[model samples]
Target: MGGLSDRFWNGAAAQLVNAIIAAVNARDFDALERYATADLLFCDSRGGQISGLARVIDWLRDVIAADPSFALQVDAVTSSNGSALVTGTTVSRFFPEARRTLWRLTFSGGRVSEWRRYSADPLPVPPPLTAH
Candidate 1:
């Protein structure tokens, strides 16, 4: 039931990432925390830092309020040893921009031990519309 590198463990970890994104988009914080470790550390592209699951929950709530149409797209997943890295882009309707991010997850005893987030670039400014 608790073995790293096993098919069950790997699949569960992958699903956890998916569930986290879904919960974030749906604004279901309670469900989001279920996949996070207690000491999770999240760093936003804007240089904001959120440490621990409790703080993450608060930060997410604020984000949902500010950006009602926030959505995440998982682009790739890579795993080795006991760690997995998920890369994706987040699209926000309020600001109408997109940013790429990588989420690193570490597993221990079939449970998430740590989760860290890093962004590849700042949210880009959309170009103004012009008619020919």
Candidate 2:
């Protein structure tokens, strides 16, 4: 049963990762909004202070707009206790560099309640953000 639960959770995490990559790459704000909790919290290592769903949406929009060259591809996903860890790599169109990243996500009512992004390789920073 534990294995079953683990597989289920890991699968869910992978699904969410796919949706996130697709939504963000496609610039589909509606999909992103639908997958989020009203009080969704995104904490990246980039160093910033913010709250509210609108702010999150704006932050995402800003990131997408600021770095069109950035792309993320999930390599693996593992989950336990309603939390999932995603191992991925960030690729860029213009730059020849690829950076590894790990994302931790907690779920509430099937939506992402909290999201944390960490740099796996080096320099734990997200793509780019325009200060608002």
Candidate 3:
């Protein structure tokens, strides 16, 4: 595992990313038990952070259960060096609009060691530049 090449690691990372998204969308976080390390840490864009796989799983469950229409549409995944970065659009009935979130994951011993999600809300476009 540790001796794997960048290509191999990246591929593995991508697979992990997809599996995580699927589980989250299904609201079955228990399926992620194998993917997360015992001491995994998850940090959210809302300044919320949780450590330990069990705690993280609980937190995810609450977030997913909050909105019945909650869904994540993954746009891209980039992986390398034991880490993966995933960007996706989040649609939730609880929110007024769609939001983009970037998920960064680090892997160790073939399980996710840390996960960070950064949420980015869309901003209105500004008017075109004009000479004063």
- For each candidate in the order shown, give its overall lDDT on alpha carbons: 0.67, 0.72, 0.74
* Candidate 3 positional error at 94, Å: 2.3
Weakest ten-residue segment in model 3 by summed lDDT = 122-131
Clashing residue pairs in all predictions, respectively, total 0, 0, 0
Clashes of 3: 0
Writing each residue's lDDT as its tens digit, candidate 2 over 1-132 gives 387777887788778867876776787878988887888777766644345557777877766566676677788888888877888877765345888788887888888888877864322234345376
Query: Per-residue alpha-carbon lDDT of model 1 for 1-132, expressed as tens digits?
Result: 346546665676678778877887888877766776777766544555556778767766666666676677888776666777898877876444677778887776654666665765443332122233
For candidate 1, what is the TM-score? Answer: 0.71
lDDT at residue 94 of model 2 (Cα atoms): 39
For model 3, the superposed segments whose C-alpha errors exceed 4 Å read 1-4, 121-132
Q: Extract clashing residue pairs from model 3.
A: none
Q: Whole-model lDDT for model 2 versus the true structure?
A: 0.72
TM-score of each: 0.71, 0.80, 0.80
Candidate 1 lDDT (Cα, whole model)? 0.67
Question: What is candidate 3's lDDT per residue for 1-132, written digit by digit as tens?
Answer: 345577686777788888877887887767788778999888665555677888777766666556567777788888877788998887877568788788898999988899887875421211122233
Model 3 TM-score is 0.80
Best by TM-score: 2
